[model samples]
Target: MAFEPRQTSVGGNIRQAGERLFAIVEGALEEEREQLALWVPVAMGMGIVAWFLLPNRLEWLGFCCFSLAMAAGGMLLPAGGRVRQAIVLGGILACVGCVLVWGKAMAWGTPPLPRAAFMEVTGEVRSVSAIPAQQMSRMLVRPIDAPALPRQIRVNIAQKDVPEGLGEGAIVRFRARLMPPAPPSLPGGYDFARRAYFQGIGATGRALKPVKVLRPSTSAPPLRARLFAHITGRVEGPGAGIAAALATGDQGAIAEEDAEAMRRSGLAHLLSISGLHVTALIGAVIFLLMRVMALSRRAALDWPLMLIAAAGGALAGIGYTLLTGAEVPTVRSCVAALLVLGGLALGRDAITLRLVAAGAVVVLIFWPEALVGPSFQMSFAAVIALVALSEHPRFRAFAAARDEHWLRRVGRSLGAMLLTGFAVELVLAPIALLHFHKAGMLGAFANLLAIPLTTFVVMPLEAMALLLDIGGLGAPFWWLTARSLDLLLVIAHGVSASPWAVMMTPTLPTGVFAAAILGGLWCLLWRSWWRWAGLIPIAAGVAVMSMASPPDILVTSDGRHVAVRASTGGMALLRAGAGDYVRDMMAESAGFDGEMSALADLPEARCSDDLCAVRLDVNGRAWRLLLTRSDMLIDKAALQDDCASADIVVSDRRLPPWCRPRWLKADRRLLWRTGGLAIDLNQGRISGTKIASDAHPWIVPAVRNRKARSGNQL
Candidate 1:
């Protein structure tokens, strides 16, 4: 009874504190409920990103059951229980996102391909694009009789492999070896198979016989495809391919060296029809329409001038999206543009963070799988940073310096451009490093020289050329467009040659990368001073990334290539295959930024026609690794030598157990099942991640034994 007074004092103190906190929050939100509602969609997007990162896809029945339960619970809640109601509403929205993703996955399911010696593929050509870099043409075909396959199959036909008169809607038949989409080149890497599943491509193959056209349809090809064909045909210069890429979002024809140069120089984003391009196009439309409206002020006065501009801008964005086949990035940008334009029409805040969040919500609701793409991540990161910077007092002051002297206006404009570039880099660099292990070091300067040219010159000229082509006066405009592209290419090449053009770093841990993203969002979206707290997580991410280490060894998914860290600091390859795709992936995965051929020769390696033996010294201790073909493993003398000397034996076949007790054998069986291996010599461990851990229904199980793979198409 004596302690009752203390308990009463504690309860009274807690009650008073809670009341004060509630009053403060209520005051803050009194007039901002509508603005705060914008975050609901952003939260929904967060849930979608989380859903895609799940190890296994959600089952439809389970999702539906849970969603129904959540909805019923929310509906049953009393009106006075605001906190409980908010919790239930958030749960329902998250569950809705998960269910929508599951539905999309179900819609993408297709019948499996038959395992036969020769697949007689007969299909109508849906589209054809050339990869001049690889001397190959990709044909998307709609199979007629291949019931065991998806509706479409992508066939890679080399110049020497097939006859050349392929066009859209032309029926063609060829003999080919159909194989499943290539799996991720490394464990825990991007799943090309999962992407293919969403793209409705069940199989890929190389044409073995000449493509024989059975019939040609009367319908015209897609506008984007026709535009690509026209650009490739009419323009005959180094810049022609880039013009097509810029106009139609098709970069397959660009030279490999040029593409690499653009990537290194940070100009690659311009090559794609991304957000900047869309914004420029919309701005151009608005400016042109406003000029025309100025000539007729009476009509402009009758209608809201800004509404007309917004409507025209929205139309331009939509047209551009359709012209680019509504690619993921374009779709995302278009949604954002439409949202802001719609807000303008409704007389709302069109440039707020809420508008951005609203756009993200729309895109995720329609195409949630895009949450896993690097483009989506980078695009949103840049947008969030730019928007946040624009809201700062200094930036607003700088932007408001338009009434000053002409030279001052020009200086302010230049400063704004510089600040925009720097802010975008600050936000996007971490994402690029986390995914690609490299940041565009010369990106700011490159954008300064490149963006104005592309926006004011190249894109405008391309649009004019399109308009002129309809009037039979396109040749000069096309030439002007090509010249502008050539100048941009010159800038890209020159900047790429700089010593500090690319900053290569090791990969960040997944947790740290996610934390950085959340921190950026929190800083941008929060309205109070507490937003400054986000800086802690951002700093932590930087510290962790600085300390991260690259993998010491990388193995190809097929066991055909293996790279080990050499004493000279570059990766030494076991073999160089006909195609460098897998080898490049391995090099990038291990954070080897130099040319692949720069790998130092192994002086400690002994080589024969069938096998090579090398000594691996990690730290001060030496270990032996043997690389051998399946046939060579049958030789008893060489096998005994390998078993006696090697700490680890690597082969494409299972060998007899004649090794020392300490020796570790990496045989074909393990590699086949796991896809690849990344070893950490410093930690004396290997990453245990397996391909199956992130497997989807589209990925068929890997054959476990030699007998199962005897006649299988891998």
Candidate 2:
């Protein structure tokens, strides 16, 4: 009887504690409901992105339309059912997202090339830009004669193959063999083909002959290109490339080693014209204009000088956007800047969460596909984090101090930069790890030095140099800009060389990244102790990612490159030196050494002229794999040897009939149908998965068309 009473008392206390926790959570949620409600569209946008990343395509376009209609019907209901209205709104927005994404996929998927072949094409050169850090150039040509190709095809030409004086908007003819865009390099790797589809690029090829300029061109190259040329011509060294890259968004002249250093140090963003550069330019222009106007007492008194200054800042942002060719990042930044300026004109908070949400919604609606890209993810993550950080009490208190001295202001500005870097890295780390499988551990420290130098020194000099070049006095500005760039390069190299600089990690599952994003947003949106609940998913995601394992084998799409995990837990190349691109992809994905090791160096992999073999242990089961080429297929001795010894045979030719029922095999036919193959071995059983198959535009045009036609009926 005493034990029963004690147990009852403990159980009652536990129930009371649970009820208190629940009440606190409920109150926090209720308090945050209104603020969280605004992100419905943003959540819908994320849903749309998720739909795109799904492995298998679903016919949900009609269902999405139906849900949207149902949502519209909910709005007509009486206002009493607030909970019902919220549910209806969320489901409807999610449906709208599905519809928009399906529509974008269909729009971008305009019948991939019917076949790959050599062709003679004559087209107008829409634009020409140098391949990054390479002497070659990529020309966007709108083909007039090639009816089977996309409206615009990207043609790559060697510097020598480009005809003299050829420029943008020039009508030209070239003979080239075009192929459809390369498929995903790995299973669920970056989809260049999908990106190409969205970019209106269906075909890519190398020019077989020099481009022949057809007509007498009256117009000059594009304004951006002309500026690039003039700047490169005047600045005569490697730094000239960096100068042009900053001024005009052309990184073609940057050295590959220097670029890698920047990437390793996480300073690559400086090379790209983005939010920081745009804001600096606009702010500088605005400050100068306001000062100039302030000097004219009569004019200042007669006009709304504040409004005039805001308008001028907006205009400067627009001009700089145009100067950079309005790339995606530039356009996004410009939109945000204009939104802030518009808010100022309306006497509202310029950098409120609502303004950021509105800008994000607009960008998502117009460019739903961008959500799949690393740039959009990284860019928005940084912005969202910074905006949230700006709301903290410490920052607010610092900003409210208006009468601060200049020295104090400088100190605060430096402190703010460090905080911004930390916030951005916090948000972008998981995202970068998920997409690129790499992160710069020391990126924050690197950016502390790089950001201020680029912002206050490099960009200013570049801007001044552009202006002075028109008057033949640009040499000094360019010299100074070059010096700053050299210093930045040195810093990047030094930082990248640090022992704890770059962290190459294994691939992270998409679900982990999505969970991390959700947790981050939840914490950012809510202001309560209950917000700590968001950390659960974040911690879970990191735990899962840390446990990720590498694939046992990797085979390229063309069966030209093969890598297998050795018994010692390192990747061993079956072939050396060929398929460098594929090699790099596998190495990075598997979290092996960054460089592809020679077959001879790996003790476990033995190679001959026609064959290479490696042994892999998965779940303590031995898997013997043979990597061979076409010529080895016809050699009965080699085939017999392979069939007898190997558990999995990966070859460039069809397996001989003798080996069909004997061992599992992947050959040219299977590989061609499915872009690439990854095999998993467990407990003496073998199974394989392909990168992708007929769902791709080039693979199943007929099926895609049928699906599109049937989509309207759900």
Candidate 3:
């Protein structure tokens, strides 16, 4: 009888625990039910990421089949369970996203230039953009005579080489030296060739002679071009560039120094047309239209004045997007604004995660490739962070509270803006580090003053100046605009000059970046206390990034330039006279902002007329590297002796088979196959942009050309 009572008691306890667990799960699901849809885009984005990470294009077919199977399996599961349903939906959406990107890639992929050549080119001018800072102009041409070339070719023409009155739709002829789109200068660096492929630019080159316009453009210049000219003409000095950038979304005119200041200060977003500009303009339009319509009490009372104003605002936003050349960021913002305006017209709250999700879906559906770009990633991350902040209970209460003294209200608004800036900076830091190898530390503080000044003072004044230009009464407005821009510039330069303004990081591993992104998304997307758990991954990523070491040596794809880590913790260039672009790229990749030293100037390097030899102490081991400085051939016996003694050898010319290095032989042939190379002496590791075994569509052309050359030589 006593044993029976004990057994019954234990059973009762077990039953109670089971019931509690079920209730907890049910409650959690109930809390998150409304937010479930927000994860659909994330699922889709995962599939897109998968597509990019595949080694072979044919793998996409297998991936697609796998995704379909997952979706089908999920659909076959029971439907009444919320957890099951959520899983199934996410799986289906992910499959859809994978299929969508594959389709887009197949459809949009363009053939690259087969080989480098010098030829006379005749084509219709599709577009022209001026780079005042460089004193040059670039044109996109659709070749008529060169059927072998891509449908569109981009040419950079010197100011002296450009014909007078060159504009879009003109037929032009020029002699140029053209080459296939350049690959990333170093591993993990920017891939201009990939972007070019998607953009349909088969060739990029410099014009060797003056361009002759056989037929002048009959159509009027585009509004964007006209506005650019007007703004640059009306406003004098560097501020004119900033004004034009704000108005027309063309930032080519901005001075390099000023642009650098903005980037370092984290105010570069101001120069780009994004959510801030679009919102300010559309909000002003709606406010003005609403007031005008409300002037007639009948419209306000009976005709739905708010809806009418929203409609007008929508039209203005679309027109503005088109006028600004409809760049990706601008289009994204316009779409989001249209959604917000739609919500207002329908009398619904729209500034929720759902809104951001919808915008992401639209962009991903059309420009799936953009998901891999920094702009799409950073912009969307910032928005999600901001929206999540707004959704916080404390923040919501504070924002909703309006009955306060005028001074208090103003103070509260300023505080809110600063807080928002801080949140955005926090979320965007990892992305910046991953893409640019640096992130602005004091960006939030810089943004505090810059945002309000640009949004309220500069944009409004610039708009007025542009509107009044038709009457030639815009001088005063233009002057005001310039002065405001000058102040904004002052802020950027001052902030950028601070010692602690930016944090530089070495190349971040893909896994670390992914972890950081997931952590941030977890924290931002979830409303429960479990969201704080995301901090674990965030901190882990940052910790890993901080401890990561940079590569000791970097070799360019063409094997013409090499950089070695110097004792002073900066990079030393094999070629002392390397151009600014090469120096900057190497410096950024090394996470070093200091001036690069010449290899000959370094204490550990010995240079001759033909070669530079470096001895490095890496991880307590002495490593010797021999780098060729000239194309002159060395005596085979001397080359073999030197190569046998060295730990690594890099040469612009192909090394003889007898000249074998102990570790690596990075010669012209090897570099041609690997693209760019980064060597880490500490870890005894080497990374390249392309693997010899992989055959991606973008890489096939280069491989084929190389094979053809080898065949001819044979």
Residues 1-714 of candidate 2: C-alpha lDDT, one tens digit per residue: 654656458778998898787566555556766576657656677568656654445536445655667777777755545544655777677777766777777766554565577988999888888764677899888888666778888889998787876677788988999887766756646667777887888788998776788963567777887788877776656677777888888888888788888888888888888888888987897789889998998978897877888899999999888889776677778888998888887888788666667766777788877777888778777888888888878876765556679999887877777777888887888888877777777888899998889889988888898899789898999888888888888999999888687666655667888899888887777666766888999899878777766667777767777777766676767666666566668877766655666665677767777777776667666677777843743578766876688888888776666764234676765665555655556423322223232353434364344445544432
Lowest summed lDDT across 10 adjacent residues in model 1 is found at: 704-713
| Tens digits of per-residue lDDT for model 1, 543-662 | 887777777767666666778787777777777442566665776677677766422257767766677777778778887777774364356875787677777766766657674414
Instruction: TM-score each candidate.
Output: 0.89, 0.89, 0.94
lDDT for every model?
0.74, 0.74, 0.86
**Which of the predicted structures, 2 or 3, would earn the higher TM-score when compared with the native?**
3
After best superposition, candidate 2 residue 594: deviation in angstroms?
3.1
Question: How many clashes (backbone N, Cα, C below 3 Å) per candidate?
Answer: 0, 1, 0
lDDT per residue (tens digit) for residues 16-125 in model 3: 89878756766776688787788888999988887777766677667777777776776764467665676677677777887888787678877678788899999999
Error of 1 at 238 (Å): 2.1
Clashing pairs in 1: none
Cα displacement (angstroms), candidate 1, residue 585, comes to 1.1
The TM-score of candidate 1 is 0.89
